[model samples]
Target: MIYVITIAIYLIGLVIIGFFKAKQIKTQSDFSVAGRALTPWVLVGTMLATWMGTGSILGNAGKTYQTGMAGLWLPLGSVLGIIILTQIAGKVRSYNKFTVPEIIGERYGQVARLLSVIALVLAYMVIVSYQYNAGGAVLHTIFTDDSGVSAISVETGTIIAAVFIILYTMLAGLLSVVYTDVANGIIILISFMIAIPIFLVEAGGFDGMQIAFSEMGKPEHMRFFGVYSFIDIINFCLPGFLLIMGDANMYQRFFC
Candidate 1:
């Protein structure tokens, strides 16, 4: 009940932000890129939020649980990619096109632009599907009964999440996206700040980690290259790492 109330309040706040920002969006550029006026802090917040999604949290964390320390490869790769992106980020922003296709068309020709758009749509649709699924899973977990009966099915939860996302995107465009991203980042940071200490205390401290690992019978989980072949490491790191370098969201934020 408390959780639901908190979520309700948070959502209400987002809606308000969207409705407020919607009034200011008079041009296509304003809607698509927040008039290219996002401040550094807001840009940082959105970029961080975009980069750290359910994949970074639950998916990679699960991998870490299974493979121990080897799971760091994916996120480490992403971080390294971001560091590299800093080099060309200025170039991206200076190109000053509204859409990625426009930028490509200008440089590569119409055929390349068409291919890029097709690829972007296909890839983004897949990304949206996963995002909806992740939101649904979180909602289902939140609404599940003590006996583990879900109040809402995953499909229903997904639809609800998708609707909210669509509504917010239509309502305020990049303005709402960036503002809500900053808020989301703050909440996530606070959650980790509060939870990590409790988790550490529960699992016992540094010494306790060793004891816990020993009991789990997977002592190698604490190892840097735990159980991962060289091929596995490369394979795990490359996709996410490379993807971030060319992600639409990151590029959009840079353009802003």
Candidate 2:
């Protein structure tokens, strides 16, 4: 009940924030690009929050749980992409376009711009679908009673998440997202710092963890790329690589 209350308050808070921020959205630039006024830290925070989602938390964790060191492909791909992104970030910002499609139209032509927009819409739909699903999973897990009864079904929780995110994004757009992401960024940093040590300890330290892995008859799971073929490795890494490189959200942040 307490956990439910806390989450309810958090969602309500976002609604309140969105309500206030909506008043400030006087133009397309303000709504979509945040009026190009974000400083480095705010931009960084929004970029981090936008990029780091269930894929970073539940998705990556599940991969690591199943594949051990091989799971790193997801994050390692993103890190490599980010290293490359640092170079492109400045150039992207200079374009000062409202969206990635604008850049595509400038660099290529209308057909390319149309294709890019189509690609982004498809990618964004997947991202948002999973996000809503992840939110539902969170709620379903948290709402399970002591008797193992689920107070909220995953579907119901998903609807709740969908409504909240849709309303929030619709109400205020990028301005609200950036400001909220600032706090989310800080909280996530602290969560990772605290959770890592606890997880390591619970797994019985690094050496114990290795022994447990060996006992699973999957010692290769500890190796780089493990038993995966070169093609398999590339396949695993490509989705993340392509997604990060093409994400319009990051482009919007840089433009800001």
Cα lDDT for residue 248, candidate 1: 84
lDDT of each model, Cα atoms only?
Answer: 0.86, 0.86
TM-score of 1: 0.97
**Candidate 2 segments whose C-alpha is farther than 4 A from its true place:** none
Which segments of candidate 1 are over 4 A away from where they belong?
none
Supply the global lDDT for candidate 2. Answer: 0.86
TM-scores, one per candidate = 0.97, 0.93
Error (Å) of candidate 1 at residue 78 is 0.5
In candidate 1, what are the lDDT values of residues 182-230, reduced to their tens digit?
9988888898899989988997886787778989897887778647788
Tens-digit lDDT track for model 2 on 154-211? 9999999999888888998999889878877887899899999999899898787789
